[model samples]
Target: MAGAALAGLRIVVSAGPTYEDIDPVRFIGNRSSGKMGFAIAAAAARRGADVVLVAGPVALPTPDGVHRVDVRSAAQMHDAVFAQLPADIYIAAAAVADFTPRQVAPGKIKKRDGEDGLTLELVRTRDILAEVAVDPRRPRLLVGFAAETGDVETYARGKLAKKKLDLIAANRVGVEGSGFESDDNALAVYWNGGERALGPAPKTELAERLLDLVAERLRA
Candidate 1:
C-alpha cells in the first residue's frame, strides 16, 4: 500500500545538523549525519508523496525524486522550511541547534598569550517545530524527532505535548553503533496515548515502517 495510500500527498522533511557559526572557520553543530532524515525523505517519495527535503550541511547526495534544499544555519533552515508550506505532512527530523552565538566574529578570533579561556554569549534559536505546530499553513500530520541522552520517553512525550505534535520519534544518542551518525536506529514512536517501537535496524527500513504508520493515521 506504499504507493496507494500516500499518493499525491505533499511531504516536507528537515534533515541534518544546523551549523551555528562562531567564526569563519568554526561552528557549533551536533553529530547528525542526516542519514535518518534522508531515509525518511526517500521512503516518503517512494510511497508516492511529493517530497521536499530541507537539508543542512551534509555531504550526502540528494535522494531521487525529492526536491532538495540545502541550508547551513538554523535561521536559514527555519526560513526554508516555512517557504515549503501548505504540505500534507511535515517531518522535523533535523538536529537543529537549540542556541546560536549572540554574534558571529567577522574574522577568526586568535588566542592571546595570557588568555586562559574564552566565552561566548549564546541566544536561543527559533523553535521550528513549535512554530509549525501553530502555523496557519500547518500540515495535517506534524512529526518531530527527539535525540535524547537520558529519559528519552519523558522528554519525547513532554515535547509532543508542548509542541502539539501529532507524532514524535525518540531515539537514544551517544550509544555506540546506533543513532546519530549511524546508518541504523531504533525509534520509540509516540502519538497521544498510543506508542510503538520500530527497529534496531537500518534507517531505510525504519523509515518505511514509520511512514506506514503515518499513512495509517492520516486515513483515520
Candidate 2:
C-alpha cells in the first residue's frame, strides 16, 4: 500500500449503531461495536487524509488527528455528517438502525396490572447512504456496507445500485464470531467491474487493505 495514497484528501466515515428511544430510560439498538469504522478512520488518517468520523455510542477512543463527532440516533448521525459537507470521500460503515420508535414515551413505560403485552410502533429511519448519494454535491467516492445473511453478493449488488454507491462491502451477519459486534471480519468488496475478498484478519489490517482499494479507485 502507498503510504501517502490519500494524501491531502478529506474523508468522512459513519460508524456504530443508532439507538432509538422507547422512553427516557429505554431504547432499541443493534449490536455494532464500531470496530470496523474506527479502524477505517485510523487507517485513513494514516494515509494522510483529513478524516471526520461521525460515530454513535461506542466505547472506543478517538484516533489521532481525526475529528470525531459523537451522536446517539440515526437522525443525529445524518445531521452531523451533512453538517460537515463537501467531503472528497464518504464511507457509510455504520450499521444504522433501519427503524426508530414512532414516539418516545416521556416517562418510563410501566406494565399494566392486567395487560399481557405492550406494542411499540416503529418508523423507518432515513437511509444515510442513499441520502449522501442523492445529494447534489455528493462526495467523489461513496461506499456503503451491506450486512446480509444469505446471497450476500446478490443483495450487495442490489444495494449498490439502489443506493448508487461506488462500492459495497458485503458480509454475513449472525455467523459465529463474524459480524455485528465482532472484532475480526472478512468482506466481499464489490465494485463496478470486479470484486475482492479481504481477510478474516484483525479489523485494523482489513481496514488498511480496504483504504488501499479506495485510494486506487480514486486514482483510477
**Tens-digit per-residue lDDT, 1-220, candidate 2:** 5658688889999999899899999999989999999999998998899999999999999999899999999999989999978999999999899999999999999988989999988999988889989998799999999999899999999999888899898889999878888888999999988899998988899999899888888888
lDDT of 1 by residue, 155-191 (tens): 9999999999999999999998789999999999999
Would you list the C-alpha lDDT of every candidate in the order shown?
Answer: 0.95, 0.91
lDDT of 1 at 122: 100
Return the TM-score for each candidate structure. 0.98, 0.97
Candidate 2 weakest lDDT stretch, 10 residues? 1-10
Specify the highest-lDDT model's number.
1
